[model samples]
Target: PPARGPLGGWRKVPRYNALCTLYHESAQQLKHLQLQLAAKEATVRELRGSLARQQQQQQVGVGEAGAEPARSLVESLLEQLGQARERLRDSERLSALRVEALSQEVQKLNQQLEEKNAEIEKMINQPPYEKEREILRLQKSLAEREKAQATSDVLCRSLTDETHQLQRKLASTAEMCQHLAKCLEEKQRKEKGNSDDQIATERSNQVFLQLLCFVHVLLAPEAFDSRDTSSRFRVHTGNQNHMHIQTKVEHLRGNSPGQPGARRTASQSEQTSPPADNGNSGSEGRAQGELRCPHCMRFFSDELSDEFLKHVTECCQ
Candidate 1:
């Protein structure tokens, strides 16, 4: 009678049991969606890892390793890598869209529920016989909702575990990639593969290291002092490892976190963790790890891209 069909009708139709069942069913659907989200996230992570490995392999080439060729190849590969990264960005956009849609669904359901409650007020005033029927219908629907909710809870729990595990895997893979790159560089050097070429490769590696550091700083400014200015000394030394990170996170600088500015000494700044703790340490760790971009005077990860984007958007607006 309330006209919203199943949602509103379930309130006055004397099918309490059915209403319970429907609620449970909706809950189940919510859970299924959560699981789907988790699965998609996992897939994205796998894609990132696979792409990284492929890029590395390409950088190394088919065989007979010399550093200059490798370096030039790496530069070339970087351009291709950028395209892959753009693809990943598109995937991220899709995930964001899904999140938005799901949020809208939740909002709509809440509104529908409020409307049902209003209708229930009218039902409560009905004659006893009809009221009893209405109550029973609601009871049934409620039961269904409960069951659905339970299923959803189960799915969400599974997804939480999977995401945590996947995050760990991502961290490990980044570390491994860093190590592999280093070993390859050293191996090429040891073979005396080509000094001129080796020198060029070192230049390329240095440039990569600089970019890595820049990105890290943008992502995890708190992990390293943004005030340190001895760029020459800071790049090679691990002394600033204990300093607190600062940020005006430089995402669009085409700049790495390892800018000459961060190398400056910040004797006045406290070396404490961020008190306004945002849950970014995992990403921070990825940025900080010496292995991934060890020569980094500062590092930023793509994770900070969101925060940086938000900041810039606001500033421009």
Candidate 2:
């Protein structure tokens, strides 16, 4: 009945239609796998481009302190990429095995249909299937590349966010430092100003005290007596005779040192002319702390005697 040997195998082949169904399912799975691979490759390419741009920006943006974290992130990304590539390689190996198995089945089918060799040869000669497999392979590779690129892109974005946050923090810190420096400078300036003012005030006080000492030295009764050797001066007798005493003091100043004895004798003669009662009263009045300024023709009561002395010194000068 059925042809023997090689042709007889076709009778068993129909009974094993499930094998063809298995082959079709495998082809369908391979197509899906290839599509998945293509998508992964596209994702990888996009990610790679983004990662490169981000790396350039990162180099410009970060300093040594910031570089530490960015380097860590990049290291982690690289590790993940390495793992992904390993998985992709494993998938590729598995896909190659599956394709090899499908090719063996095709060869077996060709052997079983020896009488249909010409038709099979024509089918094999058609480029469409080979082209489809090539396209699917290319898509799978592209998908793997794309998957890797996407991961890199995500890592880049995260790093960029971190960089921006750090930059903002650094800027704020710098502003605070500037503010503190300004405050310190202002405080120092105020302290310096206060010190300068204090020094100036002390200098003025010292000058004033020295001036007071000089004035005291100038106004001393001893100083006047030492300078006017021609005059043997005594206190005025009374407030009533202030004008007469002032006139005599002026005449004494005008006289030469040679007339000291004659001036003293004249002063004693005038003093004796006063009545005894008047002289006693004048003496009592002199005891009461009264002062007269010969140069200014002014008299001062006891309360104003200190000021009167200062004024007399100035007038004499």
Candidate 3:
């Protein structure tokens, strides 16, 4: 009977059954030859016994002519026995050669069987469908990995471009800030120079006013005499008028944005003088009438003392 293979089908071993049948046949033939040789030996033994009996008969007065026939028969039996032994020897040699050949063939068959069994085992462990599925899975995984790599490369390039754009924007912003800072510095420098020029002009005006006041005091010594009350009062009023003008000038300078410190210096330099006597309206009326420009001949009221002084300084010049 044929064996079942791993796939539940008949397993075909080529020439195995034929070799087994040939070996059995060879054995049977050898057995049959042995039996035939035994039969031939038994017949030879019977012929010898018969030939011995004939010799005894010849010794008991048998004829020579009859003995010659018996000897010829015995010679023929011996020749037949020798021929049977030679045939048996030939059969045994032939059987031996057949058995050796069969043994070699069986060894070759066993090696082939082992190879077939190995192939069957491999099929049972891993089928064709399973191998194909594994290959497909690996191919799909490789494709997915390649797709992910491509996406990552795109993202990296985009990020690099974005980073470069940000860097450019930052550089432009920094340059604009630097330009604004330089402009601001230049504006501040110009403002400082203008403020300094304004301060110098104000100081020169203050010096000229002081020189004019000194010249007027030197030319009118009798105006400050204590014996003349009306003259003393008028001089005090004029000094008050001068101080009021200085205070107004300091106030205007103080209000200016560029001359914040000038007010303090002007206030520190202001002179303190005695107040005038307010008991003489008649004297005040006469003093106001006499307050006339020496060169321009313009009469001025007491309230317009700063204007009057400016007119007198201009006339003197």
- Minimum summed lDDT over a 10-residue window in model 3 is located at 229-238
Write candidate 1's Cα lDDT for 1-317 as tens digits. 34453335454334434444655565565566566556655765666666576678888884335542345655565566566556656655665666566566656665766678677766665689986898899999999999999999998888677556544544543454465456545655554644544433333343344333433333342323334564322221122322322211111111222334322222123123223224444644554422133233234343454444344333323
Model 3, C-alpha of 101: deviation from truth (Å): 1.2
Give the Cα error of residue 108 in candidate 1, in Å: 44
Q: Which residue ranges in model 2 land beyond 4 Å of their true spot?
A: 1-10, 14-16, 58-81, 113-317
lDDT score for residue 41 of model 3: 86
Would you list the rank order by lDDT, best first? 3, 2, 1
> What is the lDDT, from 0 to 100, of the residue 186 in candidate 1?
62
lDDT of 3 by residue, 1-317 (tens): 32455653334354767878888998998899889889988988887777687779778976555334366777887798789889889988998998899899888877766776677677677878998999999999999999999999998888677556544544543454345445434544555657555544444343333334434432443432435654422322245645644553443334333546755655454433223346444553565333555333456654565886787766555
**Candidate 3: Cα lDDT at 69:** 39
lDDT of 2: 0.51
Point out where model 1 deviates above 4 Å: 1-129, 188-317
Per-model TM-score, in order, reads 0.24, 0.24, 0.37
